[model samples]
Target: MFKMKEKWRYLKTEDKTAYANMAIDRAVLVANSECKVSPTVRFFTWNPPAISIGYFQSLEDEVNLEMCKNIGVDYVRRITGGGAVYHESELTYSIVIPESHPQVPKNIMESYGRICGAVIKGLKNLGINSNYIPVNDIIADGKKISGNAQTRKLKTVLQHGTILTDVDVNKMFLLLKVPDEKIKDKLIADVKQRVTSIKHILGDDINFNETAKAMKAGFEEEFNVDLVEGQLTSYEKELAKRFEIEFFGSKQWNHRR
Candidate 1:
């Protein structure tokens, strides 16, 4: 049996979604500096639906805020670099582990492969074939079903991703800025061609809660560890509150270049 050198924390957040996700990422980054947690895996969903832009992306250039507000979608910025993504209709997963953790890979692509392997295993459990595409996407038949990003610090690594259960192709187009003049038509066609969902593959509605549970089990098996449900440590809670105020809840950080 493989033994993990640190404790594993399993956290499920009900509908806190964007802020909670960002808060947990920050908490894990700080916690990694203080202790060796085998790794923390969080399963979460969004409420009041939101759009998250990548770290280096220009909010004005990448997102149409007026449309977002009109549709009651909250706009937030991610700490990782990637394109903007609409967050509804997806199950999100975030993992936090120390950089020195045995399961944590050294190179970025290798790390993505390692983390996405768990996702592959999870999808296979549902009889859906999936594979990891380099640089961080989980694909089925060349169409992306999930997208992931990672951030590394001195002692910690935070990797997070979204698994599509369903997506609104039209709404997604309305929320983001596309360069082409015929973007409305192009975006709709492109998304239909390039993105897919569990519902589309399984020929039925996916039960997200079951999927989340399967994902947690997949990680536990992959890492060879017992997953114990836990809450944020007092320190993590404090940091989360602070992070919500300083970074996640701030317009400055969201708009920062």
Candidate 2:
């Protein structure tokens, strides 16, 4: 989609708490919207692991807070809308670019497919062929290996998603609420059948750094850009800090639904 300059910033994977991670994503979106930073592709992992619920989702309805607290898993609300996701043994990536950018499609579905193509290519680099399914999912070996969500704000678009390195369906189900207790087991089994991970597919674990490297190349190849390693700017850092304290880290904001 990009035909202009073939360059983008690569913010290598960083491990952080749920709040800090979300803050950085929002901060980057703001900075990119203002043209203060190059369009960025960043990767991150949730420290202590976490469950992030979608923007319109209710925390109480979607998550089991007592279970989360007991398991030492953190929780946060995402600016993007999607089902609650259990983040563990996974690589999460976010892309930030102005909505008016020449490469951005006016149609949402096309845009999702175009962006997710980068992920499909990344999975190919890992020797696991994958395809982008409409809406927002990547399937490998006929099972979902990644799920993505996107939102538009501040005249910019932000899309973030998880590529599973490993998966523990039982642990994930424990942290999420099922509408019916009786159907919980059935749901879990269904998910197990439908979702997959890199470890499961490759019969081994792929470290975060290695996965990030492959993903970085995926974006570079898809966009035909050179992904130069970089760090968050001073403005972005300060904004992230403020955003964490005021929004991502705030109970009122998280529970606002």
Cα error, candidate 2, residue 191 (Å): 0.8
lDDT of 1 at 46: 85
Q: Give the per-residue lDDT digits (tens) of candidate 1, residues 145-252.
A: 999998887668888999898878888988888887555796689788999988888878876688888888778777776678987788888898899889988989
User: Could you give the C-alpha RMSD of every candidate to the true structure, in order shown?
Assistant: 1.8, 1.9
Please list all clashing residue pairs in model 2, or write none if there are none: none
Off by over 4 Å in 2: 1-5
RMSD of 2: 1.9
* Residue lDDT tens for model 2, 1-257: 84675678889656799999999999999999889999999999989899999999999999999999998999999999988999989999999988887777868788899899999889889999999989999999999999999999998989999999999999999999999999998999999999999999999989999899899889988878888889999999999999999999999989996
TM-score of each: 0.94, 0.97
Error of 2 at 37 (Å): 0.2
Give residue 200's lDDT in candidate 1 (0 to 100).
Answer: 86
- Model 2, residue 15: displacement in angstroms? 1.5
